[model samples]
Target: MRSRRGALSEVYDLLRSEIIAGVFDPGAQLVELVLAEKYGTSRTPIREALRRLEQDGLVERGERGLRVRTRSPEEILEIYEVRIYLEAMAASTAAQRRSDFDLIRIRRAQETMDDTSTDDPAAMAAANRAVHETIWAASHNGTVVDLLTRLNNHLTRYPATTLKTPGRWPEALQEHWAMIDAIEQRDSARAHDLARDHMTKARELRLELYRADPSA
Candidate 1:
């Protein structure tokens, strides 16, 4: 039998992934008993997982009970605004601080992204996330990574991928390549500019999408 702590961790991972993958939509009610039965665990683990998720901001207390977080359009825009600067700083710092091993990891992530099919939006989005994650790691700044990770979780609660926007996949790939090149050259200023531009474009696309469908 899984230990209690192990069961808690397992349940937490499963729930968090499901929440991020849109298996649990924003504002969807999260019932302890229902989740316990679904994951074949006791309510004890499910309860603990819910508590951790609440702390992570993935779930929140609603009028009645716990439900997935639903961000307003203003909130979404605010997150992007903060993310833009943080991303730029991460790229700049990475260019200055990254080791050869960090470069290899970044290149691997970029290659994985290139290999992902554009038709598979989820895969493409996941790959894109991997590239950014590596860059965050290369920055060697735990605080930036933690802040960005939380902000990203909030963004991913939305179901649609910005990569699915017409003509965006190729554009994003080019931007990633350029940013990688700048980082490789240790050109911190260039990396900052490229990363800022990249995130600005994403913010624009997200705004357009939200304007087109507020519910999305």
Candidate 2:
């Protein structure tokens, strides 16, 4: 038997995963009764989950009730712009402050990402996130990590498949390695520039996808 908080947490996690995976299409209605039935939970947990999703920016409270948040091309670009600033700051700080152990952890995360096959978007996303988090932790900056975590919550609303395009994964891995190399060398300027460029390129890819499929 699950406790009330446990059930609500489970509901939140499941709904968030579905939203990130594009299982629930953008702007789709998330009716409490229907979600309750689908998850074999009551409306209580479903409502709790939707409220939490709203806070995470994965869902919005509309006149019709709860609906998945939809992003326009412009909005997506804006989000990336914020990410670029935050990630670059983290990279720069990490370069100047990272310990040998921090570098080792970052290298391990990158190697894990490199070993991941391109066939699995979820695995790729998870690996990518791990590498980023490791970099953030190496920075020794709590505020930067908190900001990036919030930004990531919003980013989860976007389709994970956006990272699955041809040649993108290898390019991303290379970029991560370059940032790590800069950090290991204590080249703050290079690390900052590379991190910013990496995010800019990713934003361009996302924009291209949006242009190709306006409905997506």
Candidate 3:
């Protein structure tokens, strides 16, 4: 039999993944009884999982109960604002601490981005995430990585990628290349500035995309 804690963790991961994948629409009610039935578990584990998801900011209290969290355009911008600082810090630390192997992993992620078709924005976005995740790992700061990972979860809850913005892809690719170069040279200050500027541009484009399509 699965341990109680194991069951809770399993349900939490599945629920989080479903939220991230849009299996649960934004604002969809998450009932403990329904979820317990769906996952073939007791309400105890489902309740615990929902609580964990709430703490993760993936779910929130609604009029009736908990539901998947949805952000307004302004809320999304605020998320990017927080991301900007965290990403800069990660870049600076990564530059100072990254080993050659880390550079290799970063380069590999960049190569994946390069190979991704612009016509498929979702693939491009996933590739972009790969590069950023590698940089975070290179930073080797567990606290920063944990915080950024959580922030990233919130960001991904929204549909559409800013890379889909016209003329944004090429510029973002250039910025990623520049960041790689700075990290390779161990230029922490320059890496910090580049990462900050890169995210600032992304945030601007995100606002533009939102304005163009409010549903996004």
Q: Where's the lowest-lDDT run of ten residues in candidate 2?
A: 154-163
Checking candidate 2 for backbone clashes, the offending pairs are: none
Candidate 3 residue 71 C-alpha distance from true site, Å: 1.3
Candidate 2 C-alpha error for residue 189, in Å: 1.5
Per-residue alpha-carbon lDDT of candidate 3 for residues 1-216, written as tens digits (9 for 90 to 100): 999999998999999899988899888999988998899999998998888888888999999899999767887778888899999999999999999999999999999998999998779989999999999999999998999888887877866899987788888999999999999999999999999999999888778777887656
* Pairs with steric clashes in candidate 1: none
Best by lDDT: 1
Which run of 10 residues does model 1 get worst, by summed lDDT? Answer: 152-161
In order of lDDT, best first, we have: 1, 3, 2
RMSD of 1: 1.9
lDDT of each: 0.92, 0.90, 0.91
Over 4 Å off, model 2: 160-163
| TM-score of each prediction | 0.91, 0.90, 0.90
Backbone clashes in model 3, listed as residue pairs: none
- Residue lDDT tens for model 1, 6-106: 99999999999999877887799999999999999999999999998987878999997999988677877898999999999999999999999999999
Native-to-model Cα distance after best TM-score fit, residue 27 in candidate 2, in Å: 1.4
